[model samples]
Target: MMRRPGLALKLSVLLMLGVVGAMVVDFSLTSGTDMDRARVLVFVSIALAMALLAAVVLDTLIIRPLVRLSAQARRMEDRGYAEPFVPTGLDEPRELGEALEHLRQRVLAEREELQRLNAELERRVEERSLALAAAQRALVEGERLVAVGRLGAGVAHEVNNPAGVILGRAGLLLDDAATPEAAEDLRVIMRQAERIREITGALLRLGRPSRGERGAVDLAAVARSAMELARHEAVARGVTLELSCQASEVDADAAALEQVAYNLIRNAVQASQEGGVVRLHVAGSTLSVSDTGSGIAPEAIPHLFEPFFTTKKLGEGTGLGLAVAHGIVRDHGGTLTAENLPERGARFVVRLG
Candidate 1:
């Protein structure tokens, strides 16, 4: 890159040339006088000293301040507004410096406002994205449950007949068994067939729509009846059953509500550990069943109410309990929801009004 002479350098060169021209003029004018070499030398020396002093004063008062102002402008252009800017020099230079500082302040304010707006936009977008995803998940879950209901409605009808026939044959063979062992074997067959019949019956009930009469029934009374039914199972499992009823009335099918309450109570009882407590609470239009046992598995929560989705060991649970309970609650124009307690165990809440 080619370098240009600075203000100071150019002024110094011009002053030197003027001093040499003055020396020529002086010597030419005094060439015929009695002036000697020492006097001429003294005159040249004085002129040279004055020229150097003038250069130093002009550079300090004018050139250096202008150079500093240019550097400040460059810093402003780069958005270094954190430091306060002070106008330098006098007259027009000071005014120009003040104007540059004002422009820098305005730019800084605008940039800060833009950044705040961008952050707000991002937050809103994230909230909308989360809401959209939740809605999509709900849509898919609804479609899946409807499909399962339709399939179950058909399968239950077909399975019921064979299950009944097996139950009948096993009962008949048991009555005619020659040995106790044979009778016990036939009884096992009967028990298994009976289980199949119960499952088909539950499926049929779940797939069928609610058509029962609705009336004002006491929610507390219904819950108490359910607790009584589950009392035997709780005792057998060494779990305690505690019931708290508030005598709240609600418009619902009495039989259906009783079934839901019974299912929830029975599940809670089964989930409780030995010597653990199962609590049933009925207040207003709500019924909650809580058990003091290990909390529900997180992975099983999403599919907890889906038909045939169970966390139970084989031969322990058919997994249709919660599915059927959920369907019954929906048919009653109510809701059934399950969640794990913070400390321990799980809770099932039924709301009907």
Candidate 2:
């Protein structure tokens, strides 16, 4: 920007021009006489000089402060705000300076307010997105529970018949307790038979909606414990079960988290081709399961976690593994996402924060 002329320079230029003009006019009006010319020059010079002096004083006292105030305003407009100069010993300029400073402060406050509003807007957008995603997941889980209830009804009816026979026969054996050896073996069998009942009961609980309170739990520990239970299946399938974990905790049920890990690992093992690697890696606060098998089709990625949605052969899978896994993660305040790996496989990333 062009620098404004200083008051001293402006006043000096104005005064010089005025004097020169007066000299010219005076010479033009005077008669062609040396004495008259000298006298006219003196009078004109004096009058012009006094007028120039007055102009200088006014500029120093009035015009300069006005210019400084203008510069202060422009600076505030361009740079948001800054400390302003206060005019001393003058009512008008002091008042004007205070007004300009107030204006600058107001503009600065408004600018800050605008920034705050923008940040708030972004936060709300993120919250809405998370809520929408959570609601959609909830809907999918509700549908899965409904299907599980139906399947459990059928499975219960089928399995309960045999369970009743096994329980009845074990009770009869226990009643005998004739030989020490026979009783020990019978008791062992009876206990194992009773365990099957417990498992079926647990499955029934899972098929129904859960009523557990939220609480803090350790995800890494839960995952490791679940692995101990599911290791046999991975071994049977000739797939390696590997876990890379970190110290991580979350607000969730320990049992539900175990179920989630169980479902995820079982699915990973099943998804792998024979002799494939099923890696369970937990980093920071997220758990990931990856398998070396044919990746899920792009079309199926979106529906993989839905109940009864399966990519396996007709009888190979019940398809409730991923659906149940999804529910478990949601109930624990987390997320489950599946994607096709870059090379040739599927990876599921579960985040708990």
Candidate 3:
């Protein structure tokens, strides 16, 4: 209803001053006795009316609207997401109000989506990781079986020749005995034959063929027997068989333990050169066969228990020795590993888990 407060206030102030000056001028113009009292009263009344009008305009238009808008802004800041703001006047200020409200909604939606995606991705990664672990375990078991099969072939192949020699020689001596000294020679031949048979028997106990039955095995006794058999071989090669052994036992079938020992010893023997030492350390409910010959490469060590993976030449070996030991150990709830010695040669470590 009234003019703007700033403009009205300025006009009111100017009118008040002009009225005072006009009163002064009229009084001066009428001389000291004229006083001009009626004109002065009219000017003063006009000034008062303008001042009252200016006060009304300030309250109704500028001051009251600003106070209401300020209260709305404070309410929106305090309770942002719960409600929408009332539409105010247009311009940059109006756009700012709308943008603030929409910004809250967008932030809330993005926060929710981010949490959901993080959970989903974490779940998928865990599942994939478990599957990979299971597959890796299966692959390792299969490789172990293949290794055992190859070692079995080497033992059978090497054993057959020695058995035939002892058996043939003993049979001839038994048929041709003719004197006391000859009889003693025949006795020696007979004993040698028996020893050879015992060796094969020990091996058979540890290396069960498809046609054989696996029964309760004594692993400790079998290990001792294998150490006995390797002793002579080590001496003949000018190498000392270091038996770092203590009394130990296993519930495995006796035959399998012998083969495990045999495979380990054989690898140790091959690793060492003449006069080099091979250590047969048995403890911790486990056994280790080590030799000082040629160290294995790091790359080769990983595949040492793999079937047909031999550092030996094709003609010299079939690469099943360590593999067979690994399989047999696993069958007895154990593990087998091969590595190069720090100084020289390779070491076979077997453990029954």
- Scored against the true structure, residue 33 in model 3 reaches a CA lDDT of 31
TM-score of each: 0.63, 0.49, 0.44
Which ranges in model 2 have alpha carbons more than 4 Å from their true place? 1-44, 53-113, 129-133, 136-140, 155-222, 225-240, 245-259, 270-277, 281-298, 326-353
Error of 3 at 167 (Å): 13
C-alpha local distance difference test of each model: 0.79, 0.72, 0.65
Following a full C-alpha superposition, what root-mean-square deviation does model 1 have from the true structure? 9.1
Candidate 1 lDDT, tens digit per residue, 16-68? 21332222222433344446656656766676677767666555655556677
Candidate 1 off by > 4 Å = 1-136
Single out the weakest 10-residue window by summed lDDT for candidate 1.
Answer: 4-13
For model 3, residues 144-238, the per-residue Cα lDDT tens digits are 55555556555855886787787788778777878878878877877766665554543443354323345554455566689788877777777
Clashing pairs in 2: none
| Ranked by TM-score, top first | 1, 2, 3
Under the 3 Å rule for N, CA and C atoms, how many clashes does model 1 have?
Answer: 0
Q: lDDT for model 3, on a 0 to 1 scale?
A: 0.65
Which candidate gets the maximum lDDT versus the true structure?
Answer: 1
